[model samples]
Target: MAAREYGQYCGVTQALELVGERWALLIVRDLLVGPRRYGELAEGLPRIPSNILAARLKELQAAGILRRAPRSRVVVYELTPYGRELEPVVLALGAWGFKAMGDPRDEQVVTPDSMTMALRTAFRPAVAAELPATSYAARLGAAELLVRVDGARLDVSRGDGPVDLSFAAGPGIRRLISGELAPDRAISTGVVEVLHGRGDLLARFATTFHLAA
Candidate 1:
């Protein structure tokens, strides 16, 4: 089926016409972090039906928002450069929604991509400059993320690598990162386990990312 349109020529309406469908923006959100194979996308968006997922991918591809290319004989979906221009928009939306978020319901799921994006959105360069260069290995269940902080730059990528600090991602970890809970409290409660590196490094990690007051 063709995408439903508001039949208006305004830019905002036109943009929404392209991306306002159910699960459309969330698909873009997942792809923003990195290229994902079909199964990986499905895993990230477990609530979306397979048929709907397939259809949305096709629609986005046709609209020039995303494209599929083969990597090592396996096809992966990724946003085109044009599509990536939506990063600021997505991040802004995330920041705006942060204050409105009350709590996670039982059915709500958190994926690695969402966590990565949250880190990206929460990063504070001014605060990061106060700390020395460091790298973090974040393990959330079976997912691993490598976060590197150099000067005022912060980079997050998938997979494990040699790092200065390592910790498990959980509710307490999320709270620490978001400033909802203090680092000391999280550690004392055993919510965040530091597998490697000094406790100071974990303290610095907490300072780097935070939600706006």
Candidate 2:
């Protein structure tokens, strides 16, 4: 089916014409972190049908938002520079929507990319500035994320690296960052494990990322 358009002349409308389709922006969200193979994209967006996902990928590529390139003998999808420009827009949207979030619903799923994006959106620069430079490796289920804090900036990337802290991502970590679960309680419940860092560094990590209530 042809993509539906608003048939309007406004720039917002034009932009929406390119990305307003169902599953379009979510695909963009997955690509924002880095390039992904077709299978990886499918894993990230479990609900999107394969046919629909392929169509959306084609549409996005044709719109100059993303491109397919060969990587190590396999084709992977990555955002074009133009598509990367949407990073701030997506992060801002995530922050804005976060204010209205309540408890997670039973049917809701959280992908690693989405969780990483949340961390990106929740970084507190002032808090980071007060803390020493640190690196962390977080195992969120099967996904491993490397997070580095330098001065007032926080960067999160996929995969592990040498770091000051390592912890499993679970309710405890979530609660700790949200300021609901106490650090001691998180440790006691095995929700968080300090694998390679001082307690104080873990405390600093907790303070650096906070979800707005």
**TM-scores across all candidates?**
0.89, 0.85
Inter-residue clash pairs, candidate 1: none
lDDT of 1 by residue, 30-122 (tens): 899989999999999999999999999998999999999999999999999989998989888888887677657777777889878878888
Name the candidate that leads on TM-score: 1
lDDT of 2: 0.84
Which segments of candidate 1 are over 4 A away from where they belong?
Answer: 1-3
| Candidate models: Cα lDDT each | 0.85, 0.84
Error of 1 at 187 (Å): 1.3
Lowest-scoring 10 consecutive residues by lDDT in candidate 2?
169-178
Candidate 2 per-residue C-alpha lDDT over 123-176 given as tens digits, one digit per residue, 9 for 90 to 100: 898989988899988876556789999989888887768898887755445677
Clashes of each: 0, 0
Q: Candidate 1, 204: how far from true, in Å?
A: 1.1
Off by more than 4 A, model 2: 1-3, 181-191
CA lDDT, candidate 1, residue 48: 92
